[model samples]
Target chain A: MKQFSKTLLSIGTALAILGSAAAVQAETIKIALAGPSTGPVAQYGDMQKIGVMAAIDDINKAGGVNGMQLEGVIYDDACDPKQAVAVANKIVNDGITHVVGHLCSSSTEPAADVYEEEGVLMITAASTSPSITEKGHQLIFRTIGLDSLQGSMAADYIANTVKPKTLAIIHDKQQYGEGLAQTVKDGLEAKGISAVMFEGVTPGDKDFSALIAKLKKENVDFVYYGGYHPELGLILRQSAEKSFNAQFMGPEGIVNADLAKIAGDATEGVLATAPKSFDQNPENKARVEAITAKGEDPSGPFVFTAYAAVQVMSDAIKAVGDTDPAKLADYIRKNEFDTSIGKVTYDEKGDLTESTFLVYSLHKDGSKTPAAQ
Target chain B: MSEASLYFLQQLINGLTIGSTYALIAIGYTMVYGIIGMINFAHGEIYMIGSYISFIVIAGLLGMGMVALPVILVIALVIAVFTASTYGWAVERVAYRPLRGSNRLIPLISAIGMSIFLQNYVVLAQGSRDVALAPQISGSWTFGDPQLFEVSLSYMQLLIWVVTVVCMTALTLFISRSRMGRACRACSEDQGMTNLLGIDTNRTIAMTFVIGAALAAVAGLLLGLYYGVVNPFVGFIAGLKAFTAAVLGGIGSIPGAMLGGLILGVTEALTSAYFPSEYKDVVSFGLLILILLFRPSGLLGKPEVEKV
Candidate 1:
């Protein structure tokens, strides 16, 4: 029995050594894909995943970066702030030095602190809250434009193009929603057009009749909703049923095809300011084809931006010749790169130098066309 | 109608529409608690499953080019009720039946566990993203002047009202007249005595679950089409609200659930109309607290008499 115990111990030690040897020889850099993989907004996480996976696949196919293969490790934050912080810690503990996402702005802001403090490099592809980049973290960056920029663009369009007599502003009372609404309100006030009514609606509410009645009573000709698609879809459909004749607009959060599914014909003529559809870029034909061939959707606004995040990370890593986040952050801030979202240049605050938000009129058939600007 | 009246009337209509659905879900809670003296916490998830089943059935029928709306609605309703009823029976059998007669807290904990299990089950089966179905009902009847304000009764709202009234009437009649309903009443009144009298108390208890589940399924189909969106987590809040409705109406009283649902819905709508919409939940829940503090037995609930 003593001899058998000694043999078992020897086998365990040998297997441990073999495992370590294999891990050491792989020479892979792990990029953590952290986002909502199990909540209401998990579809947005899927968009980030599609973009990151495609980028990783293409990078590895071309002999990798700095002779090291890129690997993606997924972490589901469920789009909750607390969960994102936990995921950030898990990624740090797992020795992943780079992250491509913490998708929702509310989730991203908290996780950004952890990544910044830990000296981890994170380039969020979708979170647009300006407060994220405003914190001035050295290792934190984003490929998406901020809500302030998008809000200003929406204000510009509403003021200059689709001018109306009386306006109403409604928000879902969430951080992302309320912040964007405030920005748009500020921009509109600066333009000398004030909303007749400014109010908040609960996020998961299925009833909007009372709200609609108030909008009609207020005689608002144009309504701007600051929230994700679900509530706005119900509002739109309910508004249509009541024959409310107000023009409606929202931000990129309501730009998905699901809006049309929820609101049906009411989605027609609804305006949204979203990042220019990067999947349709003529330069991204090959990448788009590759993603589509794998039966994945490439049309989400975040898809190319997430792909750009991976590209920038790899390019910086290649230029710096090491996986050190500080060196990579320094290189990324100073250099320019061509990506699926077009030429990218970062400001000192790590936000894009130029904005990409544009106004599009959604149709019932789930297609969007650039509104006359 | 004057503009103020029109607005108030519009809010009332909206309130009643939402209230009726809450009443439907509340019945499941009230009936289950009445019989077993334990809250069926998983009742809400059963409603959610009903929504998913209806969504699936509708999507399938639409995919096969089934454009006849009434036919599709009927088929989805039948399947959702049947499947959700089965789930309701299974939950009671698997989670609550074995724990019966144990410490009341044991069954309560088992109920919570069952709730979590059902939620995760739906989440794993259907991805957590919101699945939207195109609004199947459209158009409405508008009243008052369009220039000042319009009070509109949507066709979907009308359907919800009609279905809810019919279900409530049928339930009232069944409970008052049918042999199974009498058995249910007997079990609720005295389970031990009912069993002593050779009544299958277990089957009666299961029937209560099945009946409550069927009503909830009807509600699920109605709201899923009304809102045109469903997610696995949607049930949690809806369940909570319905449970609140059940408690406020007198936890074990059938009519109390209906009254509580209407009052809560109207309170929410009026609060949103007058005050900020964000405070609507606070106002409704605040009303519940006031009721609990003042009328501990609920508006219609009889005071319990403990046996010596």
Candidate 2:
């Protein structure tokens, strides 16, 4: 009887051991997808969610990275700087080693410091304030081109192509908007184009007749807006209403399909500069298809950047065996990966070394078509 | 002759337009406060809901081939006002009625709870993203020359201001002359006494909410038309500003709300454009602080006297 009991116990222990071994073999890679999943800019944040979800779907279909299925855990930051740090703390507490975003520049900048201290590797797909990386963190990298790239391009285009004798510069006054405005101002001034007026407009405002009146008084030939589409739309709409008929220009934030809708027909003939990867780029065909397959339109500027962020981070994780954030971050800083946008290498300052910008014009139909080559 | 003077004038006009919106919304705040003595923090969410409701109805109608501008606007306005009015009644029933005659603080807290609940509910229902509002009308009428000084006015902005003025005038007449309007004034003056005098205070309170909510809906429609965008949480700050306007004018006074709204709107706009964009909010809250410190009753508001 004793011998039989011992045999049964041994069999039970073996079964338990086998179950534990299989469970360990089926382990998944946990990647945190933190951003404003619920807030005003959730439109932009949704892009991050869609990009991460699609990347995970594709990676898992290909058996994931290093035989582990990539799992995305999302957090809502609501684009608030204080809340972003809280979300970062929550991400680290949950043992999430790799993080994907906090969409806005303000939230992303502060959150980057938290990830750096925790040794968690984070790549911002949308945050583009140059000052974010100017402080220098190895873990921080953005997929899209910076405002400086677009800012200089815009200023140069205005100075050389448009050649307005008088120019007015207006900003939304956020870090991304104001900083980019400064960059463009420098570029325009260097080209010997003296601006007629410089102003800053608030986001989500309803009127701009005062700014128009000022422009009218200055006899400003052109307007340069360093802001998002919301204010730019209102400015244009108001400009049309009050009879201020000068040409308008803005940075990538306002250079979207939605801007036309915001300003309606008032936006026609307005020029805005963004990345060169819009329609007519043959390199992005497969990537666009990949995005479309996930039931999302990659028409927005950040989708490719977001998708690339996921790809780069996963590659870095694979290159560095363990999940130590510091090691993973080091691996990311050292590597170069080919993306839908093209081969991207992050410099020590975590800024993309290779970048391009394009200028687009609003057509009469309110469609954004690339400026004639 | 100087550039700065022209700039200031332009800024002043911008502020006035925005202030008009604030005044319209402030009517809701002041009305609710007068009738119930409860600060409905959720009033902002009501404004947001009004915008979304209009968005859905308009977008749905546009989807079904009703693209005519005037027709769409009229139908959307009717639907938004009706739905928003219904929403106001529902809010009173759920958030306000339960706390009726309770400590003012209790009702205020519930108002905050209701505000959060509504914002989250909209987030779940509408998805947490700013819905793009495609305006039906485009182009502005240009009066000045393009090269030297061109002054233009778009159809949408003109429409918004005209609609606001007309609605506000009608609201003022309705409150002063209508049978229900007199009862509302009585209730605000003395709810217990009005109840003793054979008025169904409950129904009157609900009606005030409905009317206030409809006014907010008009403002929401105007916002959607002007900016061509709407999101679920858009009402919060606007509601606060409108409330400020109401207090600035005189909490229980209808005309005061109008004046307050215009003041807040114009102040916000001018600050944003002239000083610095970041200072816009600073200007708004700073004025609010100044008003509180100097004249707590507001620009046109009268100090309330507790009745025996």
Candidate 3:
């Protein structure tokens, strides 16, 4: 009887400890860092991860939000839509109420539907498709500008600055790539400049010889590609090999160090329209230093945007004094928050009231200079 | 040449270059099926591992400030081939050997499982992002009038042709004359009979796998250099296309795979040149269906004869 009593007492103590641990876990707010951690474009996901982690670290160091700690859980979607939907379901199952990613627009759109239905707040830091916000979901938000904004900026630069005789547009046929291509085409059409050919190329295809041959035959002077770096890198290199000599330009998706590595010297003079370099902002010196001090790159276009996403979510949670999604959503939509990307204000559609995209000439060394307009 | 002719010629050259690499990958599939009568779905992963090995070797050499391109190429190729052959042997020993003589679907499923395992393994080891290699081969030879249009062949494309032709010629000679090659043919014809003749059929089958893997590694190295980029998922598509080529040439036939690869490559190139680029895949698959509808045995494939 004495031994039985002792065993019961130990079991009670163990249960108490586990219960306390569970309580402590409940006290913290969990934000799911959902994005492509493994795929062709996972490098972009790394940019998002670095930004979110840095922001969470800084927030915890400042005594957390509403005196409760912030926790981040990472989920890999591989920038694939089906995988993103599965990830969204898993995040919901895991009871994470806040999310900071789904970087590719294709992945973000499908995942956003689940978040909206579940009343989970999601702020995509990199996806730029305008159609994402066109549905006007209350919980769907993004720190980055829409593709419509970037596409028009690119079209305007092409029309007003580097006027060419003939233009061609190609896309990878995904939601993000195809939508951005259409936006650019529409923007150019509005400016009375129509592309000679608007074609979609299958992603993951290595050879672009036929495409190059057709481009050469069409006598296009400027080629606008809407895809990520891998495909565009091959296209550029193959075009160089064929001596096609057409001026190649693409959106921010193709702007990365990998592009130069793949295309070698052919990457010179490639034009891209991307979000302004927020790390270069003098006002964010300390924030930039904090990120760099941890040996993370702060120059990626998605970095500050992802940081601002976490910041806005934490600020709203603190201001609302709770983790209620409806209340936080209402509070975030109505107010402005000063973030690493300068002041951020969301409109009714969960898009920033103002966003700036600039045209830059990318160099072979992976540096960018503002292209003359 | 007229602009039209030049465009046609350019597409043909491009197709031939891509097709040659496809042929290299297809030989692995055809030879394995010919001997074992089971599709080694994991063969694609072997090719992927080969590419990763080459990338690591080249990147390491370059990082160590080794600027000798030829030396780097030779070293990477040798290591990739040797490592990939080892993987091929292991895969056969582990995945297929245990399931031999079971339901045929059993080995196919096991092969698929192995493929998934290898892909995830690579993803965990080397990461999932595309790794780029600096192009060692550059420049091209142009023909026709530069003012209208030019048909150009890149040095990388030329290397692909030379390497593919040499590999194919060597393989042909080996199969026709070498003792191991004769053993492989005997095992493929009748494994039990070859075993009764005091020849180790298992070793012959294993040798066939090794040869196929070596060829695949060569393709992996060549294609990796030509594209200047490689990712974990590259093998999936390339493998599917190569499988298609193997089937189109009649699975289990060596020369048929080569012809099928060239045909498929040229068809894709011409379709993309004339129609929308996205439709190229559709047209190529459609051609495959049409051909199969007429000749279910596939072009150059001998009709299977069953003995009751």
Backbone N/Cα/C clashes per model: 0, 26, 0
TM-score of chain A of each: 0.76, 0.73, 0.71
In candidate 3, what are the lDDT values of residues A101-176, reduced to their tens digit?
Answer: 9999999999999999999999999987788988979998989887678777778888888898999999999977
* Each model's DockQ score: 0.56, 0.34, 0.62
- DockQ-based CAPRI category assigned to the predicted complex of candidate 1: medium
Taking the tens digit of each residue's C-alpha lDDT, what string does model 2 give over B1-308?
34444455546656776777787788898888878776778888888888887788888888998868778888888999999899889988988888888788987887788899999999998887567666566776644344444444567657778888998888778888998989999998889999999999999999999989998999888877776677766787688778878877778778888887888778876765556455767877788789878987777766777767
Give per-residue CA lDDT, model 2, range A286-342, as digits (tens): 667887876787776667677778888777767776667777767767888876567
* Residue-level lDDT tens digits of model 1 in A232-285: 999998888788879999998998888898888899999998879898889999
Error of 3 at A297 (Å): 8.3
Using DockQ as the yardstick, the better of models 1 and 3 is 3
Candidate 1: pairs in clash: none
What lDDT does each candidate get? 0.91, 0.78, 0.90
Question: Candidate 1 vs candidate 2: which has greater TM-score?
Answer: 1
* Model 2 residue A177 CA deviation in Å: 1.5
What TM-score fits each model?
0.78, 0.70, 0.78
